[model samples]
Target: MTTVPAVSPAPSAAPAAGSPAEAAAPRRRRFPAWLAVVPLLAFTALSFGVPALAMLNGAFTAKDPSGGASHYTTANMTASLGGAYLTALTGSVKLSAVSAVIAAVLGLLLGQAVVTSRHQTLREAVLTASGVLANFGGVPLAFAFVATLGNAGVLTTHLHLADHGWSLYSFWGLVITYLYFLIPLMVLTVVPALDGLRAQWREAAQNNGATTFQYWRHVALPVLTPSLLGGFVLLFGSAFAAYATAAAMVGSSVPLVTLQIADAISGNVLIGQENVALALSLDMVLVAGLVMAVYLPLQRRSARWLD
Candidate 1:
């Protein structure tokens, strides 16, 4: 038997590294990140952007002194920039600032307390209360404040606050009423951020012989500052834009920007003052825009740590 040597199999050609067959890993690519917010953006544009643009356009438009029709003018801007409108703007700023700062401080303490609490039921109860209170604004809130602090209110009548120089119609009274919801809203905002704080970070700080104050100042606070500031900005905006509460509570006694806008639209007997209301709206929107511009960057920074 002639044993012929088995022929070696012919060498097979290997695929090049760049060839599709050799590319086992799928091509690395990313989905459009903005797709996540597209619906939100769409809703905002339709509900917010459209109305805002219309208001902005109307801000410059004026009644034609000659033709008795609408025409472009700058008088609205000039008028809104000074006089009662300016005073109302300043009042709004002062009130919003005071309320926001108070709410921020109180909310931070409340949030931290809830986060550190051992009782889950207590936490849930507090959060539920907060959620309800945060939404409890506008007419109902005003009514509640009136019932509690008004001249004939339970607290006022029973306690005789009037005798003691307390007045619910005053600026300070408005701040107190605003705090009812603002503090709870701040709690809702900051609690989640507080939750984002990892226990390990605290442990790490402690292992390094860090004191409680040192840990909070160096680690916890830096992470928390952005969220605190963002919440404060939101509270400020909410206060600034509020109308129904102030309207139902104090009316024109307080020269708030919201009141000024409402007056310009409804109560003003002056012809062509409707344009001035739109101008006031424009100013408010500008201020809100500036505030949000500041808040957006802080929010982005905070999200990095929290997320």
Candidate 2:
């Protein structure tokens, strides 16, 4: 049996460096990641970028009174930042600040309670409700509040709230109405941060002879400050940009920037003020940009601790 030595199969050759197949391997892996983000980028460009560019063009450009042509000018921006427009902007800021403060405080307390509770079902239920209520705003929310707390509302009539000077269309009333959704939104925003707290930290605080209040005051609050400030900023921005709810609830009584913008757009206050509306929109964008500037840093700081 002089069989020849069996030869093993030869190993396949390695792919050449920079070959098309080798180069294509990385691209194939990256394609899905880019695919996922491309839609988002396209949507943002269409929905936000295009409109923002148009707003900028309109804000600095003025139409001829004789309807002859358009020209670039700063009068619209000037008018947006002065006189009654300034007053409306101020009112909106105040309203947003007040609502955000109240909501942040109350939401913090409520979220803490929910987080510390031992009942899983209760936690899930509260979180689910918060998510729903957080998103439940706009005209429907306005109508619901009006029907429940308006001048001739059922609650107002039965509870005699109207007799006690409880007007739902006043500034304070708008604050109360804003709280309906804002608190829930704060709850949603802060709950994750609350959950990120470590049990070991609390144990360590207690092992150091710290009381519950001392633990939270000295240890937890410092860690949670960024999250709290971030929540406040989110709530403030929400209240500031809100349009339909305030429009429906208080109409011109509140003097919100949003209402003024609407007036300018519709020519309700002055004809040919469409450019002015765009200018007001620009002002709002700047305010929103400032708010986000504060918020993003806080979010990054919080992520260092929580995430």
Candidate 3:
């Protein structure tokens, strides 16, 4: 032990903050180094911003179909919110709200089945079918529903339900039609969120003697809140913007926003047709804008969760 002199303790490495060069190292920017966003910015400004601004301006300006000069006023907006328009607007919001609830509940169950089932093939097939049906709205879906449930259709006539014949041109019928698309949409929106759940968490919860409800309450539900809200917004927007489906299904019996808008434009309404049409479009924009106001923040928060 005494054969060699004790070696001096190795000098400790200098701390990073102690070195000027290390301390002065430039931090990398969070954004990508190679991305060129100027084109995207320009495109958005031209395509979306310009059109939106123009629409807002047109909403304020009064233009008569008689070739009179345009003047800014609140008359158009006030007329746009008339009783009929208000009724349609309320109908749309209420129907959409109901559809969203129905779709989300059914969709969550479907998503759970798809994710947890052992029969992957069957689940995949069902998912594919749901997707196809979700996009299969417009005139085609209306025809399909009419052919199945209309008075002259096979089911209605053969089953002797003539006394209680279901009219395709009714609000209830529209709700059913909307559900057809909305349910599948919910399945698609929610499946990914369910699939993203970690098996390990469930296992850990079980190992710790947690019940099924406890696991869902403490873990799954919180994680799913964002997706649930986002899906509701998506369903509402889809139902709100839908024109062809509602047009074909109801065919002027029920005055939805889209239906009213269509009538104002080309339904032979001689009174302020162009201006009223513009007003209808503006009304739809306001409703859509309200949904978007809720949508954007939910989307941003969801993105943070993913990150």
Candidate 4:
């Protein structure tokens, strides 16, 4: 002890900020993150981007009727904007608007109820059901509805709904059918917004002597408006793009743009309308783009308030 003091070990040095070790560490970490999204990006490119590009190319290019080379032209685009095509477009828009409005209102009410309920199981049940029902459409759904509400359906036969002029092949009937899935979609979209509502806001409103209606009308509605509009836009796009159910249920009787596109592609209505189908698809893309433009802003606004 008297001879010498014990020597202390030196601390280990960290890699320098600009060192290869430090640089390589981040690269190693980032590689996995980037790799994780590669499959998703590839899938999107293959499924959506490629198809979209092909559609755009086909929309503006027309094959010669006299067995000549294909050439770029605007005739298809012009044709899509008028005549029967225009009628189909207008009909689809009207149908989408009507269904979306009705579904938005009803779904908002239902979501509010689910959010306010005290029962956890009931809330889960409703949400689970909504998730399933929201994705339930196309031919199976069409068949289900037809079996339940068609002219010779169980309900029509038992309840005399057909005799009362309740036809499932009509516009109003399609509206009703759309509501089946649209309302559930709205519920899924709005429930998270409802859940974002802070209890303090309600408490503060009550402390300020605000009634339920007053609180909702003045405070809650303003905050929730963006989300409501966003949900409505989603529902509208869903209804507008829907094809299988409309195709299987009412066929050309509905005069939907989607149905028209199918006719153009299959040449059922006219030969050499394939390019026109692409043009109609382009029109739909433009409409969807406009809708998304509106929806994105509303979504951002809602996020600011809710998040």
Q: What are the candidates' C-alpha RMSDs?
A: 6.1, 4.1, 7.9, 4.2
TM-score of 1: 0.83
Error of 1 at 203 (Å): 2.8
Worst 10 residues of 3 by lDDT: 267-276
**How well does each candidate superpose onto the true structure, as a TM-score?**
0.83, 0.86, 0.80, 0.86
Task: Report the C-alpha displacement of residue 28, candidate 2, in angstroms.
Answer: 8.1
Per-candidate Cα lDDT values, in order, are 0.91, 0.91, 0.81, 0.93
Question: What C-alpha lDDT, on a 0 to 100 scale, does residue 34 get in candidate 1?
Answer: 88
Name model 1 segments beyond 4 Å from true. 1-43, 298-307
Candidate 4 residues 1-307, lDDT tens each?
A: 4778789998989998898888788453345567889999999999999999999999999988789689999999999999999999999999999999999999999999999999999999999999999999999999999999999999999999977889999899899999999999999999998998899999999999999999999889878988898888889999999999999999988889999999999999899899999999999989888888877877787666655
Q: Which model, 1 or 2, shows the larger TM-score?
A: 2
| Candidate with the larger TM-score of 1 and 4 | 4
Q: After superposition, how far is residue 118 of candidate 1 from its true place, in Å?
A: 0.9
